[model samples]
Target: MIERPDDAPGAGLSFDYAGFGRWYDSYRVEVLDPALVEVEAVVGGLLRDALSERDLARIRGPVGRVKSKPRAWRKLSHRRYVDRIDVVDDIPDVIDDLVGIRLTCTNRRDIDVAREVLDALPVADDGRARLWLAPDSERDYLDRPRPSGYRGWHVNLGLAVDVGGSRQPVSCELQVRTLLQDGWGELTHEDTYKKDGELPPLVEVLSRRMADLLSTLDDIAEDLRDELDRLDEAAVTSAPLPLTTETEGPGRRAAQAADAAAYLGTRWRALDRPVDLAALAWELQRDHGAEITDDWFGFGTFKRFLSSAVPAAEITTGRNAYILPADPVPEDDAADDAGADEHDGDVPDGDVGGHAESDQTTRHGTTGQGTAGPGTADEAEAAVPAAARALHRVDRTFPLLGHDDWTRLFDHLAEAWRRTGAQPPTDRLARRLIQSTRDRSAASGPPLAARHVEAVVRDLVAEGDGVPRPADELAGTYATLVQQRLVELRLIGARNRNARAAVRRWIAF
Candidate 1:
């Protein structure tokens, strides 16, 4: 039996050790349900203590993937235990990173605050009491960084996972890093380090040099953060004091409402998943717009507002589920000349959100905002142009995923999501994103990109569309998905964004 890793209320309570007998065993996926549980349970605890929006932004991962099968085998094949029984009994210690939740921040100050919060984790039994943390479980990379220049804060944590209706103890690794540190990893292709080989001497030397440079940048970033904090404090102090009628004036109230709506609207639109209520609340309060929505956010007033200008059904998964109001009808501007100023090169009508092909999916018993209902994938797939499907294929040796392909693919995904009401598969999308990132030796440094990969995967898992991708043939298909994402910027130079940005980086010789 695995010993308890921490003193959380139900840590490691009668967990099924036999469940993880092999890397590819049936329970491999089953055991992963806890990783999902660990991400939110931990992050939410951190958020409850955040004093400001800047503090909230310090922790950006909704969560990333549970380590994949191929990656797991690479990790344990010779590194930990060779036999299954030894591995299963001491699971928490052997696989300390089953669920890796990265908290990427702007500066190191955020990391200090996060460490303080971790001192009193919210208990999981009912999300209330403080879960006891083992003081020795923390690994501080900053104090003794890897010679390769790697830097981050790591900690092993324990929590109970619900498996087959039984509460079982599980574990996760919380990685706290500043954005600059993450970016250095991305630019350096550091993720491939998990695959078990030292980098070529030239690459390693360059990576180490960049790591040192990034460390200096981290110091500069802290200085910039201190300056910003001072400015923010100054603004609050210098603000006009509230009088009998000054604080909540009608004009002030309207401005606040408009500001919050616009900020949240744009942010939600950019994300592939929902923003946490705590994060939303903090930002709203910072902007002085918290009450403009409602008093009790826990009731989902802001949640409904967040979905769209109109009310939408809450997503069963407990993240944000939204229903956008229909596009406003274009008015005939009383003159034909109103159209004269429009660009002739305006994305062709069928080229963007208005694809005629989506109509086919809509007609196949799918409503603009109704569930595609489990069987709609086939219908949705069949409805898309064959050329669109053809473009998903990778050349393996050359860049093949293109802009037009991405345009149609996004258009199709947008339509499927719109007609079916189910969001597109973002976890697979994140995997695809990670794959594409790994394939690009030409991509930016490894630090930030790696962290972003972790951050995006976390949110995707929390949201719906849990499309499971096989770990086989990963090398062949790696670049296909991320290249599409690079081109997913609403079709404005996105194609070139991937191609052009590749050479734009300055790597050390």
Candidate 2:
């Protein structure tokens, strides 16, 4: 979709610097230097904002620079249709046409981010941006690599701005990347891999190996950076400790210790005081060391210890844990209660109260009637028969319901429960309805249909009934119900559907 200018060779006029430099100097001062200065300032400002101080410090020289060189008349002179001298003299647009800017970055990812940032910037009236990953007009050393074997990201941008009241197109190349990659590229450029000729087989192999190593190093560095961010987030919410040092230590080991201590301290502070501070300290040290040593601790030893040592009520992850006042009823439950009250006198049959319904159901089919009003028992039993008929009807109507149709049906059931006094026949009935709706919807059209079912499942599991579950046990129960329904509907194939599984699958990693 992006329209690029045709760059076929010999399509435009070229000029010899020896003859044109003198004549062009008389008419127009070289403006490429000033344009480059402007680009450098912009790029440096962007880098400062996007990168941390440590990363910024490592960058060598200016982030970007521009260069201008006149093409040889012989190279530029060839005109399939016109002489080079005539082409230059007749074409007034040839002056100030050749310009380039090179940007150097620390790593490939950084280079990508930099390119995105630059492309997002407001463009000049006549400027267009283009990127070249390897050697091209801007950088031509890919075939003949440098000794150090560094590769850089380069961009050739053409400016359409009018200079000195003349309508002329100018080109600038921008290069970006990490200091390490830049260093490697520079070394390779200077040493063995200049553009003179084809490189030796040994040099080629070595260059490729070095390139792989550079990529691996970058990946490792990025992972470390991500871990550091996680540690920082944990640290901010932690309580200030009297025994803790004000200055955090350097490297991964120290970061891990600080993060562990901070996490434990924050979580434990909500409990009664005179806490086992020494034990906490020991746990932090042990866990921190274990992460680095990897072999020091058994798989779940540290986790188990932390869980047992801390108060279950105080320990929270993935979701918040707050104690609600006793008898605190969730809004949806309250709504359900209010709805149930409206149908109190209208009990289906054998209904002593709503509490008895949950007691009758078991993993295996054993139906013992709880204390329901004599009037409600007949209706409740009749409702079950009606639900069975409805399920049979749905099965016949849609033989192979996909994911989305099943979701829609379940949504319909849930809405029906809320709006009307109709209760689903059983949890099994609700599960079937969900699956049938989801399947029908998926079979309807686009590939996103299945994804939509997944989204709804995720939302239900994450924030059930749009109310926060205060206790882990309560949350786990609701999560399990949702997971069970999803599995029954074939939306989520069975593997693991425990508390930890729910957290890992639904919550953002």
Candidate with best TM-score: 1
Give the runs in model 1 whose Cα sits over 4 Å from its true position. 1-23, 83-93, 122-135, 194-197, 239-509
lDDT of each: 0.44, 0.37
TM-score of 1: 0.43
lDDT of 2 by residue, 1-509 (tens): 11223343333434334455565454335455545555566557766654433345445445343322234222343343324235445533332223445555544444534443443232333233321121122332322334435556544544443467654444455555566666666655533243334467777667668776876787787677557544433332342322223332222245454465456546555432112222343345444642422311211233333443343423223321121111211122233334444544432222111111222111111011111111122222212211111211111111112222333334443443343333334444344434543554335432122222333333344444432222233324533544443233222234322212422222111
By summed lDDT, the worst window of 10 consecutive residues in model 2 runs over: 362-371
Q: Candidate 1's C-alpha lDDT?
A: 0.44
Summed backbone clashes in each candidate are: 19, 52
TM-score per candidate, chains pooled: 0.43, 0.38
* Model 2 steric clash total: 52
Task: State residue 3's C-alpha deviation in candidate 2, in Å.
Answer: 37
